[model samples]
Target: MKRNICWIVLLLVLAGCSSPPPIPYEAPTLSFTLNLPDYADESVKNSELQDALVQRGLVLDRFGRIVPLDEGSCLYPIATRTALLKELEQYQSSSFGYTLVSLKKQGDDYFFFPNDSRSQTLESLTLSFDSVLFDLTSIDKGTLVRDWTTHFAYLDQTLLVTGEQHKLLKKKHLSFALRNILIVTGQRASTVGELSMQFVDAIDTTRFLVLTHGDVLRSCQALTQGTMISTPTEPYSRESIKSQVKLVSLLPADADFNQLKQQQSLLSTGRYLTYRGDIATLIDRCSAGQGQSNQALCHSKADDSSARKKKVIVFGGKHGA
Candidate 1:
């Protein structure tokens, strides 16, 4: 009888050891500040700026109400205005004016909308859970139907996450991590559009995830390619490779709207695989290629113009002769 009891106890212990750890729970609070130039007093620019600020999740009141802003009442949560004002005093830029509005976390369950307020909710979707993974696949598909502004394309379907994948991410020391793959299907109308996947750090509440859609796509292709190739010296037939090598090449080197839109069309249906890792590395990679492409486009455009001008001069001389 004692032997049976001991065996039962050992089984319970082993089962407990194999179970996943419980996720910590804490309701998230939202806070942010908007800065507008003081010169924006009742001007059309000022009104536009206010609208822009509100669009980026700065319209919550202390009572958790989404309200319109008055000229001086642009401050949300109203409690952090003094701190924001103090922080703004350190600004040295003398370029254009800015109006400063800051969001302060007043209570639990209040969430800020960084994207479109009309599409996103003002309350925390992850409420009542400390660490949870929210699946975005469905939400993204639905949003695409309602919002014509987004362009999406399918590169390939990948398993969302596996036990091994979760273990890999956890080994990298990320908590409260979430992952999703979103395809930019339609063409982007503007050159300024960017794809960013960021997660708010549970410890410090700082958001991190700096890779662009291009960066992520290239990384995925390279990794998958390397895995399929058996040797470094092996020659790859272009047709055998399933990767879209031309998609990312179309990203504009400059900020020309027409050129940007044209290039974005090429990115339509490109596959981007998402991964979670060290925040510092992601930030470094994002900053490294920030404007290099745009600058290259500018230089290329200059060269073309110079060549055209020389041609015009030569044609005029030939006609005069």
Candidate 2:
């Protein structure tokens, strides 16, 4: 994922952000809980369901939510926003994964809308949590068949979403949906148990896949503990930061999106994406200016065209403001 950070920075910058103050943002917690529908079994509750999840390569995190253990049956992807988006973009770029719709969360469920980078016009669908995995298209079929502008989502747009909805996914981070074949039908319990090690990538809070081997049950604990980052702290170098900040936005079209799905390569890739996301955050501050609270303004996508081009620092590994 470190190797791919260069491209991701570009993707985010190119993707853009909207207007907001430079005040510090408490990192959004990606921790989630699986909400069982009325029809699913009720017996998989509390300890009984927890025990079943444990048998199936899962464990309760410190936050008391169920997360995947690093065993051969499940994977837990923990990374920052930049790395996660890059992995999502690169997964498709490397011919390993493809971008599904960005997720729109309403109440307990997530709906799919076309917000992919290529900006294609595609079909919309809803996603639901079955005990073990996510179903890409919903029986509900097409969602809110309305104006296209309302459906298209972007990562940094924060504004009021009006009328008729409970809650919409305001932050435009990527959602990694399941299409990988490692956890297959019929051989599900057996094949999936063995294929967990190869998992790469993740699903955002919406449509997170939770597999319950023994259970009715259903949980994020990984994130950097920091506030308002500007430059590399004592241990790191400016040279490393600049190289990562430069965006090299090209990705191969030949790769299939499936390669990064369902235990494809290594969790190390997910870690790499998180690293990039943190660096992306760092650049937002460093470019805003050293020690100035408004330094985050340097990278805000909502800024005008001239502002977008005025990055305070230069890249290609040189170190000077």
lDDT score, candidate 1, position 209: 20
Q: Candidates' lDDT values, in order? A: 0.27, 0.26
Best by lDDT: 1
Q: Provide the RMSD of all predictions against the true structure, rounded to 1 decimal.
A: 31.8, 27.6
Residue-level lDDT tens digits of model 1 in 273-308? 222211111111112354666445434543343231
- Model 1: residues with Cα > 4 Å off, grouped in runs: 1-110, 114-122, 128-214, 217-234, 238-321
Residue-level lDDT of model 2, residues 262-303, one tens digit each, is 112222222112211221111222332355543443333223
Ten contiguous residues minimizing lDDT sum, candidate 1: 277-286
As for model 2, its CA RMSD to the true structure in angstroms is: 27.6
